[model samples]
Target: MDGQENEEHANRGEDVPATDRAPRPAPRRDGAGRTGRRALRRTGVILAVLAVALVGVVLGVLAGGRVSTDIGPFQADLSVAPAFGGGTKVDIPPLGALLLDSHDGPTHLTVELGALDQSRTEALLDDPASINRASQSAVDDVREGVLRLGLRTLASAVLVTLLLALLVFRDTRRAAWAGALALVVTAGSLGTAAATIRPEAIEEPRYEGLLVNAPAIVGDARRIANDYTRYAEQLQRIVGNVSQLYTTVSSLPVYEPAPGTTRVLHVSDMHLNPTGWQLIRTVVEQFGIDVVIDTGDITDWGSEPEASYVGSIGLLKKPYVYIRGNHDSGRTAAAVARQPNAIVLSNTTTTVAGLTIAGIGDPRFTPDKNTSPAGSGLTQQTADQLIGVGDQLATTVRSSPRPVNIALVHDPASAGPLSGTCPLVLAGHTHDRQVSKLPEVPGKGPTQLMVQGSTGGAGLRGLEGEKPTPLTMTVLYFDKDKLLQAYDDITVGGTGQAQVNLERHVVEDPQAGVPAPVTPTPTR
Candidate 1:
């Protein structure tokens, strides 16, 4: 019965062998795989979009117009050329208008950086491979920013080409044309940036070029630009101080001299201080000075390098009568002689402002050829020569048609012999001022020695030590008869920028023997 049942089931096909039955179709796997592929496509599109946006921004920056910004005291304008292999140029317009006319006119300076170095170009591009991680982190940041921007631009180009091919053109030929045009634009911008911009543009200047050629042109323009900025700052500071000084002086009480009297400005021991020129010019114009007397030490070492400063005195537009001090060399005297308005006196007499002036320069050369530090002290030989010169000058004055009204010398020691020869004696070299009336010379009138203090406080040396002497200048007023009547002393405390004090000292008639009048107390 079992055999008969098995035969019947086999015959029915439901009982067919398992191996002979066809295998059921494999389950569908398109769902997860298709999902993954769609996710990848979305990610690529997003990346492409970001890249395209980055490229646009970068191209705009590169092809944009020039940039301008202020760096400290300077206004700088920078222009980058668009063409490959071209250069970048920086222009600094003339600052004359802002300089208070310190210069003759507006001066423009242009700096052009030719084709940039490869390394520098790479740095500007922010190529991480070219940057060193050990040196500075800023370089790394720059590189990262550049790379990120560039990658996004490339990705965008790819995505746009794909979109054009599938959505717009739906053709390979159109997609290729669109992709090529986008690449060309991006390449052009990058190429221009690489050619023009350089690392030197942003680097700190060395200023080494300043030592070689300065106040005019420079090999390294960036260094000069930096120096110019600093100079502008210093100039502004100096101008402010000078303006303040003028305002202060104008507010002080005026010292009116006798009518039709001659006024003389006495300046001494400038010691190469440029500020002295400014002060002297101011005093000459303000006082209506008829003559200028400089009892020298005009230069610090009296070297050939310092001779040029002598020309500045001629700017006073007054009769500049000069006598050499221990610090002045023959070169310095020669320079003084070149000035049209300068009168160099060496045991000679010249009439100025209707008064006979006799002067004898210090005879000894103070600068030793072999000394490490230049010598400035008066030597015995010079002292002896000074004495002889003084005697000769006194004799010459006595025999002249007009008696010497004023006697000028550098050292007070040399001024002793001129006492009886002239009523007024002016000298400098002590860096300290003094007023003294010599004993009556039996037959001649009594002589008054007015020694001026250092006009520049010994120049830069004044600021070296713990205590520095004050800068001083004197103005002498003459009576209608050309006789000394009164004088005003101007003193500036400290060096560089300082406060000015004016003191007026009167000279009473010697015959009356009355005490000299006290200086009027300053109101401010």
Candidate 2:
């Protein structure tokens, strides 16, 4: 301290106060810098301790990763066929190094397990598997709890210390005890609140999905396994009838009739859910439609995790045409390709009874690597399904002698190169979650690109926060001019989270190849 002032005095030609004459800092009694400094020191020590604790938690999670899991019988390996998605399909290796199907062999649950990143899966399986806020939510909750507790403890301690300082050490102990009581009370109240707000975790809770939660996300998958387990002993078990609840929603579609077209069928982002597939059978039969086009996401969800739901799904009738969706695993399209009835259009053309169709599957605004299991929350394996469709389109143009030119794709952005060439463009990645038309493209014929909404919401949504996305599909009819005639907004809600109820545009002209009178779009 003396040296600091001496250096300043030498540089500025100032005199230094002598030790005896120097003024003291006045004990800083009211200023309380000492107390403040001590409090800060305490806080810093607490924070450092907390940081180490967090690091320990992260390390523990990494080391224990889903430690032990039992997915039961459905946990069998699914022999995924490349022919399902076609176009020289490539198999997705499990975790690069680990083979999910090798030890005790591949089980259905293993497929699902293989799809998830290890850490996330482990956190989800945490003992009681916290259901309050979910895995990520629980992590955040505990962190906040610990921090608030620590802060409150410090505050109470400091305040008590300040009051106690005016007295003797004998009374200081009492002040400390009061501070401890405050911490206990605060912790108790906070703990109670956390418990009250926490939701129930589905730890294999016979899960008949009564609400929107992680369990519901895999409702179909769960149901599929249950059917096999008891030979469907609970198949007839009637809980609250969600079937009747579906009637409350509206349904609609967008289709182009030559001049004035109507009664066309459209489905998008099927993601090849069995429920949507089943609906397709009824839709074609009921509407007595000439065309059915799937915008994309027919199959391919990282792994065969969702494939377990395909038991009843494969029974659905094939669509006239399908475009690749980012989520599609390519299994649906690959299966469809085996039959002449189903067609996939990537960047090329297809004609359904001379109606020109063009589609591009999940087109390139990004690399396929980034598409699934990341930005799209899907795996690269599923994203590859869209690519297979793209390759198919490329092959269709080269192999076929006739120009069956109609493009199919999972994304609107990739349709960039083929815009002006094709008369009709169809897509489905957006899922019609919004209440507006988003088809704005220079290449999508004279009109905007068509975004076909999903016909199946199923178990695929978050609870509370996720809005009511009804099941709906659109159909476009092209007369000679290929102008859109009537847009039917077919909404189907209440069909559980998975039912799809659709209605077609009332077509005035039913023709093999004639143009319908052009009518303006209806005002909703």
Candidate 3:
């Protein structure tokens, strides 16, 4: 194409006017523009491709290597349980059933899956039957495999970059810059994750707390890395799909405006969203909130998923009551409890403005060796790791002498028969999975109920009763009578409010602030 004609084509990536429709001047095969432009086209592709490839290498090298199984039939089917020779079991769930078996004699199998515990793992290795040495090999394999994957990822980038450089940009720098940016992001992300993954995780996260729960988290980083490498849908599934959720709206109004309390905003399962966190902040400021109670799951996977924990922490700083959600990770629970302003009461009772607050129950009924029943009291209580939480909760409630009681917990199931005796109960584990004023079982008194909704809650995808439980948050405004009173309902991702009766509550002050209210309400 001539220079003038080429200029038009370059500016408009399509035919101009197209009166004749004459094959569009042969589509600029060679340099159609100026001599400099032509020269750029000739050199840019080579440079961009090289730059892209180089970037990929850096990314791969920076991230840990992934171990790839090359030889052997380490294949196990979904039907098989992930087990060791001695029946040590692991659960790799949400994915499906797995094939876990013992091979040959001792059934010693060395897998580069970066999670096996070497110490206890070594104990097993010593067995005459165990061939798997369970050492640095797995780490090395994962690290190497990650690098290889990075290389492959970079290779793809180079090819795409080459074409775009030669045809689209006519300058190598743009494509090279994009490629380099990808590499930089990958490297930086990997570097940060590596630092955060820690020796604890690297050494033996899988077999650490409870061997059963380890397998799923063992390959988490690697799998997340792989999915995110090519910007795959799988990556989106983890990060993107986690937010933007909905739950059923409750018919019960939280409160009827009363004298003393300014505004009572009930919220639960705010699940790691800064914007959602900001909502409570705005509401607290707007409504003049007296006490904010959190049901639970403030952190996803507790501490294991540090990013979510850190991100959510910023969103949740306020004079409020908090409960645990099933998704809460260890780090977040720890952080919240440690906060000077954070009042974390497990089964213990706290009296706030003459109101009794008590809490109990966690999302997980079966205690993993890592956490206690009601969770580490307030956050810093390490005693939970040993004595267990459920039993501890019962003991804790007995400690409190508060007249009015407010109960808090991670799950609604814990609201068993004895729950209503407390007067007011608050929970979040169910995520409002099922809606409809729950008919009180025969003996229990009338207790207001609400489960905070989360983007991670089960409701949005479908009915809570179908499979995953729905999510929602419950709010209550206690009146001066020490009676379980006004209630309001807040739905996740919804806007609008219902006015409720407000009450004036008085209290006996403790050194920390207020003594435990008559009712025990554990902060999840």
User: What do the candidate models score in CA lDDT, each in turn?
Assistant: 0.64, 0.43, 0.43
Candidate 3 segments whose C-alpha is farther than 4 A from its true place:
1-256, 262-264, 304-317, 361-395, 433-448, 455-472, 492-524
Model number with the top TM-score: 1
lDDT of 1 by residue, 1-524 (tens): 35566567678865755555556999999999999999999787555544543444344434432344322222334333233333322321211111111111111112322232545533423432322332245445435544444445444544554454445446565555556655665555544454444565433322221122222232345665568656445444544555555565555555698688899999998877776787788788877889999998887667665676787877878999999988888888999989999999988899998988988887666642221111256466666766676677778778878878888888777766676887888888778888877566778777887789988787766766667667789888888788777778887665435477888877787332222766854632
Top-scoring candidate (lDDT) = 1
List where candidate 1 sits over 4 angstroms from the true fold: 1-243, 368-382, 510-515, 521-524
Q: Which prediction has more favorable TM-score, 1 or 2?
A: 1
Per-residue lDDT over 384-424 for candidate 3, one digit per residue giving the tens place of the 0 to 100 score: 32225434554565466754365666655455432334555
lDDT score, candidate 2:
0.43
The CA lDDT at 208 in model 2 is: 15
lDDT of 2 by residue, 193-259 (tens): 3344312211233321112233444455446654553423222121112322222222223343344
Error of 2 at 59 (Å): 44
**Cα deviation in Å at residue 450, candidate 3?**
3.4
